[model samples]
Target chain A: MSNQDQNLAATVNTTQGSYRVIVGRDVIDDLGTELQKTGLKGRAFLVVDEVMFPNPSRRAQEALERGGYETHVLALEIGEANKNLETVQIVYDWLADLLADRSDIVVAMGGGVTGDLVGFAAATWLRGVAVVHVPTSLAAMVDSSIGGKTGVNIPKGKNLLGAFHQPKLVLQDVGHLKSLPAREMSAGWAEAVKHGFILDAQLLDTFERLAPQMKALAGEEPVAAIRRSVAIKGEIVSADEFETGDHRVLLNYGHTIGHAIEKVSGYGTYLHGEAVAIGMMAAAGIAERLGMIDEELVDRQRRVLENYDLPVRASGLDVDALIEATKSDKKSRGGTIRWVLLEGPGKATTRRDVPEEVVREAVLAILD
Target chain B: MSNQDQNLAATVNTTQGSYRVIVGRDVIDDLGTELQKTGLKGRAFLVVDEVMFPNPSRRAQEALERGGYETHVLALEIGEANKNLETVQIVYDWLADLLADRSDIVVAMGGGVTGDLVGFAAATWLRGVAVVHVPTSLAAMVDSSIGGKTGVNIPKGKNLLGAFHQPKLVLQDVGHLKSLPAREMSAGWAEAVKHGFILDAQLLDTFERLAPQMKALAGEEPVAAIRRSVAIKGEIVSADEFETGDHRVLLNYGHTIGHAIEKVSGYGTYLHGEAVAIGMMAAAGIAERLGMIDEELVDRQRRVLENYDLPVRASGLDVDALIEATKSDKKSRGGTIRWVLLEGPGKATTRRDVPEEVVREAVLAILD
Candidate 1:
């Protein structure tokens, strides 16, 4: 209703469902207020990541209680390694034990892994209930939290098991970013920077100009960058709720190689954003080699990633392992690895006919 | 398309997606042809239930192969106890090993449990893929197969963990119903019969007339019954794809008590339809006490169920356990058990304000 609320929040409409993503400083208090608007009167089961900053998690619980909700908080000590069906089972059992019903809400307050795990449990428990996401990490606010892509990873791959369950609301408090380590904060920037590469050149320019200040979460630049990134993602997802069309795939500009990097190097080695930073480099290289983008654009993309202190390449990478990992990606359908390559900043396309040799070369060049 | 193809198949449109449920004698052979029509070209990974009649499962595989599909069969030794996240994990591991891609189809061949487990796997595998269900059991063909609700049970309850993943096609061969023991066939009748009670009075009349001959699976009556049941389910699901609206809850006429019976007695103790048969009686008793239906109508309903050899009551039941189990049903919202009570035969209403004492009396009357 107020200007701040309008500025801080964006509504995402998808074929599956629609939800609002509110991003701003000290916005955790607004979670209870937003949830109340949906008219979901039930006990709120809050799932928080124990390893991260606990202040916001506690505050979120208190706020919900203040808003006349019977709040129950379950602090989970989970990371990428534990982000599998095993974790989903643990959460499902807990919810069942709590006598969680259809009207009850599952509030997932954590980073990408926590959101994925909790959102998934919400998606399946009682055949899905309302899930409100309080994404703490930057990647989650700009990407995972906006779209209803909830899933868990298996031993063989990342996000191999998931569902297209849209959230009831996504309350993103930018203040949470201050609690993250600098590296973790910057890792989130890689995805925001990616939005620039795929869809918004001016937003990419904002990131380039604020590369140094972005790491500090200071000024209006970081907030503006995040808002722009969320908008880009929200638009793409609205067009193709499921990945059945090309519109959604463009949002995966760096994810193809990024996911492979995370898989081959092990999930914990690099933050998802860091992997995508390197993946973006590889994708840029593939684009340049194919004459879609100039060498200067490729270098600019690499430099922007480096300026944010994110890794543009990995050391000691096995070409075969990366290739094999890419094959396992959901994008590599019909036995062909489709690459989302940038023609230039803010312009991207998905191609399945990328020659294997070229893909090998591109992947090889990204390794130290 | 032949006259039988036009006559045998019914189209189900849902908000999530749309597919056709083809029902007839020897319809299993038409699997590949129907799949081709959907424009989904890929290798078919057939997931078969090794227990119970295997002939239909094998025949289904051969038919797909004959229709120019490269088929792979994984026969599962599964039952109610095995239908959990653990089974889902095993299936996921197998699909991962087979290098199953997003475009490749996962064919679920068997009854409800098999369709459910396989369908859940398909729902999550690569964040879902094309799944075609070949329901060999009567309950599955008439009820579970038509709806996109796929899930597994947890330690606490049945189908507590699942997803709303619709099938690309449902191929139901009446011939497979013959392999079912007379009991299984009758259990399926309970659901088809419930359809009569909830939405179609004329259909109920047909069932009453055919009650003596229904168990035989002979003549056109059984086929017509199955067809009418599918149409009822298909229409309800199309209007309320997700159970957010009242239309979908109408289909839960007997499921409230039926699920409670299965949960209290343990899932494997009774076939789903058998439990629903008892549930129908309980619901009918509740309806009669509420003055919604007269004594003679209730007796008529009981007589028809008896004629089909469907149980109208349970031998032993814990009133408290049944009540607790009903509270956990997906329909129960805000800790209130919403009963889908019969206004009259062919008319039902979901009521949450039904006196607790009345519900207990209804349960007590059905228990010896």
Candidate 2:
């Protein structure tokens, strides 16, 4: 409604559903006001990481209560190990015990793991209830929270089970990013940087110039830079909500190798963004080998990872196992991996013809 | 393309996606032709109730193979008891073991439980794949297979965990219904009968006139009658796929009390349709008490259920638990049960203002 309001929020539209994403410091403090501005109304049940139990979690509860909702909060130890149906069952039992109905809302108040687990519970509970996300990590704020992709992993693989259930609203407060562990924060930045590599050169420049401020979680530049990343992701997902089309494939610039790396190394052994950081290096290598991009661009992309203190080389992963995992990645259609490769900064494309030997060499080169 | 083809197939459109339901005797034998006509294609994985294994399941595998698909068939003991996440896990494991990709298809080749469990697996596997349901039972062909309502039960209750993942296509072969146990046949007809009572007086007339043949799964009447039922369901779901609004709620005519009965009686004690048949009688009693419909229409509805050998009453049930379960039913939004009651034979409407005492009286009247 106002000039400042327009700049602080972005809306995502998907065939499944649509919702708004607002990025601001006041989002948490003014959570009540923000929700009142949206169409969703219900008793709020908040699930947060156990670490945030007494502070931001408690604060989020108070904020929801102030919005005139009957709010409840629970905290759990959430991470890659905790992001499975077993955790989902606990949330389901809790909601059932509380006599939750369809009009009730589940506010996922943690990172991607928390959002995936809690958001999944909300998606299937009573055939779906409104989920308002207060994503606490940079990875969640800029990427996972915006898309409706909600799921839990099985022993079979990572994210092998999930649904594209859009949230009712996403209210992210950047101040929470400061509390994330250094490794986790860097992992988050890796995804944001991937957005720059695949979509926007200006965003790449912004990240390069504001790397220090962004890392420190200081100044307006970090927020502005994060917003650009969010905007690019929002646009891409809006264009292709389901990865049935090629449009959304570009967003996976580094995820082909990244996901394979996560699988081969075992989840939690390497953070998701950390895996992607190394994967990005491998993708660049493949692109350079194919002459799609020069070594200069590949080297430049590697420097971007280094700038954020993200890993550029994965150590000791079996190259054959990694190649096998890539073919098994969800993005592979008809058993052929559609590699998301960069032709240049701000330009990305998909190809299924990447030879297995080329992939093997790229993966092998990335390992120390 | 031909009038004969038009008469056999009905199409469904939902916010999630759209698919077609083709009812024909040759559906199984012509499965190859039907699948090729649709856009879906890939390797086929079919899961059926163990009873359908040697016959329909084997025939389906052959049909798919004929259509140039790399086909695989695995049978499971799918029923209300088997329709849990554990079964879903088995399917997930099987697909994962087969190295299933995004483009592959999973075909559910049995009744409602088979559709729900396999459908939920299809919905979540690789974030969803194309599922073609060859529903062997009457209720599944008319209801579950069209709406994309896929889920399994938890200890908390029936259908408490699921999603609205629509089937890519539903191909029904009426010949299979002939093999259904007498009680199963009666139970399914209860749903088709419900469609008539709530939405179409003409359909109600057709069922009343041809009740014997429909029950016997005899002649052209059974197939014609089933198609009419499918059409009614298609129309209702197309208008409101999620049951978020009034149109789809009307389809839940007897489900409110029926679900409670199923829950209170313990699931296997009452076939879903039998419980719904009794629920329909209870609803008729409620409508009579509320002065929404006269005794003549109520008596006529009772005769329809009796003609089909469907149960019109229940025995040895706790009225209190039944009432409690209704409040817990998925349709009870905001903690108030929106009872779908009939104004007359051809009309249904929702009312949240039904008194607790009134419902108790209805339940008591229907208990032997």
Candidate 1, B55-133: lDDT as tens digits = 6677777778877889888888877879988888888998888888877999998889999999999988877789999
Segments in model 1 whose C-alpha atoms lie over 4 Å from true places: A1-3, A320-325, B1-4, B52-54, B318-325
Interface RMSD of each: 1.3, 1.4
Candidate 2 ranges beyond 4 A from true positions = A1-7, B1-7
Q: Score the docking of each candidate (DockQ).
A: 0.72, 0.68
Q: Estimate each model's TM-score.
A: 0.95, 0.96
Best by DockQ: 1
lDDT of 2 by residue, B1-368 (tens): 22338555578888766777888675687676677777667888888889998887888888888888888888899888777888899999999888787778899999899998898899888777888899999889877788888888778766778877887778888888878888888888899999999999999999999987787776778888889899889888889988877899898889889999988887789998999999999998998999999999989999999999998999999999999988878777776788999999879998889999999998899987
Question: Distance from true position, residue B304, model 2, in Å?
Answer: 1.2
Q: Ten-residue segment with the worst summed lDDT in candidate 1 chain B?
A: B1-10
